[model samples]
Target: MAKVRSMFREVLLKQGQLSVEDVTTMVMCKPKLLPLKSLTLAKLENMQQAAQDTVRQQEMAEKENGK
Candidate 1:
C-alpha cells in the first residue's frame, strides 16, 4: 500500500495536479474521504473538486437562462 501511494503521489506531483502542501492537507483529511478503494485519497479529492465545479457551472447556466 505504501509503494502504491508513493507512486501515485509522484505521478500527481509530476503532472502538476497537486503540490506538497496539498498532499499534507489531504493526509490530514484522509478519514473524511475514506471508504474509497479504487482511487487514492488525493485522486478522490480531485474528483470531488471537479464535480463541484461542474455543478457550479451548471447552476450558473440555469440561472442565466431563467433570467
Candidate 2:
C-alpha cells in the first residue's frame, strides 16, 4: 500500500476499502457537573480573606497601642 507516487494520470475513484459505517443513537448521559468556583478563584478568595484578617489584626493591635 505504498504506490501512490503518481505523476497525475488521473484517479477516477478506485481506492475504497476503509469501511467505517457508524449508526447514530441517542445517548443520555450525566450532566457534566462543574465546580461553582475555579481553583484559582477559590485560592484567591482564601488569600484575600487571610490578607483581610491579617490587616484587621494589625489594626486592632494599633488601636490597642493607641489606647
Candidate 3:
C-alpha cells in the first residue's frame, strides 16, 4: 500500500500537476481516497490537461481584466 501511494504521489509530483505538500496532505488526511491500483496513465494525462486548460483560462481572464 505504501509503495502504491508513493508511486502515485511521485507521478503526480513529476507531472507538475500537484505540489508535494498538496499530495502529502491529501494522502495523510484521506488515505483511502485514491484508488491507486486502478489509476491509469491515460487518466493522469487527462487530469493534467484539464488542469492546464483551467490555468490557461484563468490567465486569459486575468489578462482581459487588466489585472
Candidate 4:
C-alpha cells in the first residue's frame, strides 16, 4: 500500500500593533568637583557640637545645685 502526502501546509498568524522602547545606552560624563566639606568632616563637626552642648548642660546643672 502507498500513502499520499499533501503539498500545502497550514500557518496561523495573529496581527498586533508595533511597540517602541528606549534602547539608547546611558551616557557618562566627567564627575563634578564641588566646593563642599567632606562627609567625614561634616560628621565630625556635628559630633563636636553635640559634645559641647552636653558639657554646657552639665555645667548648668552644677550651677543649679550650688544655688
Candidate 5:
C-alpha cells in the first residue's frame, strides 16, 4: 500500500497535477499507521502545493470568463 501511494505521489508530482496541500489533505484523510504518517505528510505537501497552483490558475481563468 505504501509503495502504491508513493508511486501515485511521484506520478502526480511529475505531471504537475497536484500540490503539496492536496497531498497533505489526502494523508490527513486517509487511514495510515503511525510510522507512515510523517513520510506521508511530506509527500502530500508537495502534491498539495501543485494542486493549489492549478486551482489558482483555474480561478483566474474563470474570473476572466465571468461565469
Candidate 6:
C-alpha cells in the first residue's frame, strides 16, 4: 500500500498538475474514495481540465495586459 501510494505520488508530480501537498492532503483525507481504475481515469480528466483552464486564464490575462 505504501509503495503504491508512493508511485501514485510520483506520477502525479511528473504530470505537473497537482502539487505534492495537494496530493498528500487528498490521500490522507480520502485514500480509498475511488477504485484504482476510476481514480486513474479521474486524474487524467482533471489534468486535462486544468490545462484547459490554464490556457484560458493566460489568454484572458494577456488580453487584459494589452489593454
Candidate 6 residue lDDT tens string, 1-67: 3534453443435555664353444334645564557877889999999999999999999999999
Local distance difference test, each candidate: 0.72, 0.90, 0.72, 0.89, 0.74, 0.75
TM per candidate:
0.42, 0.57, 0.41, 0.51, 0.37, 0.43
Cα-lDDT of candidate 4? 0.89
Residue pairs clashing in model 4 are: none
TM-score of 4: 0.51
State the lDDT at 32 in candidate 6.
55
Pitting candidate 1 against candidate 3, the one with the higher TM-score is 1
Q: What's the TM for model 6?
A: 0.43
RMSD of each: 24.1, 10.8, 26.6, 15.9, 28.4, 26.1
Q: For model 6, what is the error of residue 5's alpha carbon versus the real structure, in angstroms, after optimal superposition?
A: 54
**Candidate 4 Cα errors over 4 Å, as ranges:** 1-31
For model 1, residues 12-35, the per-residue Cα lDDT tens digits are 344546535534443344445545
Give the lDDT of residue 19 in candidate 4. Answer: 60
What tens digits encode model 3's per-residue C-alpha lDDT throughout 1-67?
A: 3534453443424454653353444334644576545558778888999999999999999999995
* Candidate 6: residue 67 Cα off by (Å): 1.5
Candidate 4 deviates by what RMSD?
A: 15.9
What's the best-to-worst order under lDDT?
2, 4, 6, 5, 1, 3
Q: How many backbone clashes does candidate 3 have?
A: 0
Better of 3 and 6 by lDDT: 6
Most lDDT-accurate candidate = 2
lDDT of 1 at 64: 100
Q: Is candidate 4 or candidate 6 better by lDDT?
A: 4
| lDDT tens per residue, model 2, 11-42 | 46578665556999999999999999999999
Tell me the lDDT of model 4 at 5. Answer: 78
What shift in Å separates residue 9 of candidate 6 from its native position after superposition? 62
